[model samples]
Target: MPSSRISEEITFRKLEALLAFMETGNLAKAAEALEVSTVSVHRALHSLEEGMRCALFRHEGRNLLPTEAAHVLADVARDVLKSMAEGIRETREAAGYSADQLKIGSLYSLTIRTVPQVVIGIKTRRPDLQAELVLGSNADLLYKLKQGAIDAALTGMPEPDPEIESIPLFEDDIFFAAPADSRFARMEAIDLRLCRDEPFVSLGEGFVTSSGFMEAFRIADFTPNIVMKVGDIFSLMNLVGGGIGYTLLPGRVRDMAAGNIALIPLTAEFDMKQTIGLSFLRRRERDPNLLALAAVCRMTRIAR
Candidate 1:
C-alpha cells in the first residue's frame, strides 16, 4: 500500500486504542483507561485492523494478544507517542517549567552503593530537575520499565530484551562472604564446587543476584545449599556476618567494615562476573532526561 493511502486510513483514535491495548494487555482495562465501553474499544481495535490491512490481535479465549504484526506496529506507535510527548515537554520547558521529572529504578544491591553515588552526581549537575528512585528486584524493575512506569533503571543485565537498550556500566564479581568464625572465612579464592556443600544465605529468587549465583553454580555443575533467603544485600551481608551461612555478594558490600565477614573470590574457570548496567526503552533514547542519565553513566568506570 502507498504511504498516502496508509495515512489516510489511519485515525488517531484507533492508534490510541491499539497502544492502550498493548500497554494494558487486556481490552477491558484499556477501555476503562480510555473512558469508553468495552464494546467501543473492541470496535476501534477491529477498525484499526481494517485500516492497516493486517490482523493485530490474536484471539485466545477472552484475551486479545498482539500478533507479530501488532508487535511490529506497536513499536512504531511507541515511537510516534514518544515523539509527541517530547514535543509537549519541549513546549513546557520553553514556558519556564522545569524539565519533566525522571523516574529511575534500581536493584537492591545497587541501592546500597552505586545508585546513591550516581544520583548525587545527577543532582549536582541538574539541580533544577526532579529525580525519584524506586528500589525493587530486577524482575520487578524490568516489568515497570516495560509498562512505562519508570524513565530508566540501574540493574544487572536481566536478559537480552530487545525493547530495552542497555549501556554497560560495570562488572561486579561475586564473592563468597562469611563470618570470621565460619569454616569458609579464611579462604583466599575457593573453587565453587568445594562450597556447594556449604550452607549459604542468598537473595530471594526473583532477584538478579540470585539468578546469577545459581547460573554460576549450574555452570560449575552443582547446586548450592542455600540455607536462607533475604531480599536486600545488606541483610544478606549481615546474615553472613552473624554466621547464619555464607553468601555470594558483590564487591560493593566490601565498602563497610564488618568485623567477622570476609569476601572470598571464586576460582571457577567460567564467567561468574555479574554485568551491571543502566537500561531504558530503546524508543526513549532521545528523551532528554534519559539521554542525560546515560551520559552520567558513561563517565563512570566498570570493574573488569
Candidate 2:
C-alpha cells in the first residue's frame, strides 16, 4: 500500500526517468533513449521510489519487474508531461511567437531577390524567428493577409484599402521580354501595337503582372495573340527563355535575364511600373510579429 506522506525529493525529471525505464523494461535501453548514462537512469528510479515511499520495482535475477504502483505512477506521469508541453506551447503562442515560425506571403516574381532580403533581415533582427515564405499573386497574397494566414505580404501595392495598411518598398517597371534570338529582341524599345501579331504567354488572372500585361495591350487598342497562361513567374520566364512566347516582366527579375531572354524597354506611351510594398491587416498593425516585419520593411531601400 502506498503512503500519503509525500517527499520534496520527488521531481518531474525523476518521474520521467521512471516512466522511461518502466516503458522500456530495461535500464540500458531507457538510458539510451533519454541520452543519459545507465547509472543515472537507475539512480533516478531509486530516488523516485524513495520519494514516494513505495515499492515500485523488484529484482528478478538481473532484470527488474515493475510493481502495480509503478504502473499507476507512470500513467499519471505520461498525462502530466504531455499537459506541461501543451501549456508551454500555449504560453509561447499567447506571447506572439507563432511556434517560432514567421509565415510571410509574397508574389512569385518578387522571389528573385526582394523576398530573400526581407527574410534575412527579419531573421537577423530576431534570431529565433523562422521565416517561412508563401508565394502567390497579388490577389492571393492579399487574401491570405486578410484571412490571418500570413504575418505580412511583400507584393505590388494596391490603392489605399480600408482593411489593410502598407509600406512601399520599391518600384519596378514592366518591360517587354522576348527570346534573345527573336527579331524584337534587337530593338532598344518596343511599341505594344507592333507585337499584336506576336504570340504571348500571360500570367493567370489575379496576378499584378497580368493586369499590367493586359492594360498595356488594351491601351494599344488590340488583343495580343496570347498562346498560353501560366501560374508562376519562373515558369513564364522559362517559357520565354524556351522561345515559347514573349511576355511583360518586371525589372526586378532582370537577374534572370542572361542568355536566352532579352528585356526590351516599353515605349513611353505604354510604360507602366508596379509599386511593391509590405502589407498587413489594419487591425493587427500593432502585433509584435507584424511590427518586426514593418521594421524590416522600413530598413529596406531597393533601387529601381
List the candidate 1 regions with Cα displacement exceeding 4 Å.
Answer: 1-87, 90-99, 302-304
Give candidate 1's whole-model lDDT: 0.79
User: Each prediction's TM-score against the native?
Assistant: 0.65, 0.68
lDDT of 1 by residue, 227-300 (tens): 89988877888888887887777776677636768877877574477788899998767766777788778765
Pairs that clash in candidate 2 = none
For candidate 2, lDDT tens digit of each residue in 161-271? 999999988888889999989999999899989887788999999899999999998899999888999999999999999998999999988898888899999999999
Please estimate how well model 2 matches the true structure, expressed as its whole-model Cα lDDT. 0.87
Native-to-model Cα distance after best TM-score fit, residue 97 in candidate 1, in Å? 13
Angstrom error at residue 102, model 1: 1.3
Candidate 2 to truth, TM: 0.68
